[model samples]
Structure formats: C-alpha cells, structure tokens
Target: MIRHCVFIRFRPEVGEAEKAMIFTEIAALKERLPGFLAAHVGANVSPETGMDKGYAEGFIVDFADAKARDTYLDDADHRRTGAKIVAAAEGGVQGVLVYDLEIPD
Candidate 1:
C-alpha cells in the first residue's frame, strides 16, 4: 500500500469554509479515481507544540500500490484540486508538503 500525505499552510485570506471545501474536494477524488483504499482530511489537533510548523490542515490518502498513487497524481481532478490548494496556500506550491510512504504487507 501507498500512503500519500499532504500538509498545507493556508494563506491568511483563506477562510475556514474555503479550507473545508478544499478538503471536501480532495476526499471526493477517492470516488472519482480508482485504487483508493481510504482517505482522511482534517485540521491539526495535536497538542505537541511546534510540531506542525505552520501547516494547519492536511490529508492522508491510501492507495493499493505505487501504480495507484501514480495514477492519482496524473489524474485531471487531482491536478485541479491541487491547484486550488496551492492557490489558498501561503506560498503557492511552496506552502504545501507531500510525503509518500510504502506500507509493507
């Protein structure tokens, strides 16, 4: 399995409603694309200080394998949603961080 994690530091002008809508759009990709095993999106509620840096929102997407993840990365919907996220982020594309992990069977 492949776990695709994304963290975002939204711009000051981006409201809570817009943030929620961004996450909702991301979650909806699971239905539009294939090989999505699971997905979770929400705000950072960690008690640990200084851990999250400036990233307040994030999402994790689980895919069956690397191929699935690759497909998702190339999907049109994913690109559109990513553009929205980047636009809302502080430094455009630089305001987002993406990490992919491979889960052993």
Candidate 2:
C-alpha cells in the first residue's frame, strides 16, 4: 500500500468554494480508478504553532500499491486538478509539499 500525502499553502485569496471544488475533483477520481482506496482532506488542526510552515490544508490518498499510485499520477483528470492546486498555491508548486509512504501489507 502507498499513502500519498500532500500539504499545501493556499494563496490568501483562494476561497473555500475553490478549495472545495479542488477536493471534490480529487474525490471523484476514486470512482474512475482501480485501487484508489480513500482520500482524506482537511485543514491543519494541530495545537502547536508554526509547525505547519503555513501549509494549512492537505490531503492523503491511499493506494493499493505503487502501480495504482502511478496510475493515478498519469491520469489526465489528476493532472488538471494538480494544476489547479499549483495555481492556488502561494508560490506556485513551491507552496506544496508531497510525501509518500509505503506500507507493508
């Protein structure tokens, strides 16, 4: 299994509606792709201050394996959605952090 974790620092002007649309686009991919297990999206709720480095929002996507994860990466819809996220980010792609974790089953 693989966990795709993405953290973002959205531009100040990016509103809730746009954020919701981005997340909605991401959520819809599960219906079309195999082994795209689940997507968890939300804001940073940690009590600690400054730890997030201004990345207040993020999402975690679970995939059955590396193949499934790669499939999602090559999807056109995901490319578009990722473009949107980059656009909404504070410093374009630099405002986002991605970390992938592989889990043994």
Deviating ranges (above 4 Å) for candidate 1: none
RMSD in angstroms, all models?
A: 0.9, 0.5
- lDDT by residue (22-94, candidate 1, tens digit) is 8888888888678888989998999998899999889999999999899999998889989999999999999
For model 1, what is the C-alpha lDDT against the true structure? 0.91
Error of 1 at 12 (Å): 1.3
By summed lDDT, which 10 consecutive residues of candidate 2 come out lowest?
19-28
- Candidate 1's TM-score reads 0.95
Residue-wise C-alpha lDDT for candidate 2, range 1-68, written one tens digit per residue: 99999999999999999999999899899999999999999999999999999999989999999999
Clash statistics: count for each candidate: 0, 0
User: What local lDDT does model 2 show for residue 5?
Assistant: 96
lDDT of 2: 0.97
Instruction: For each candidate in the order shown, give its overall lDDT on alpha carbons.
Output: 0.91, 0.97
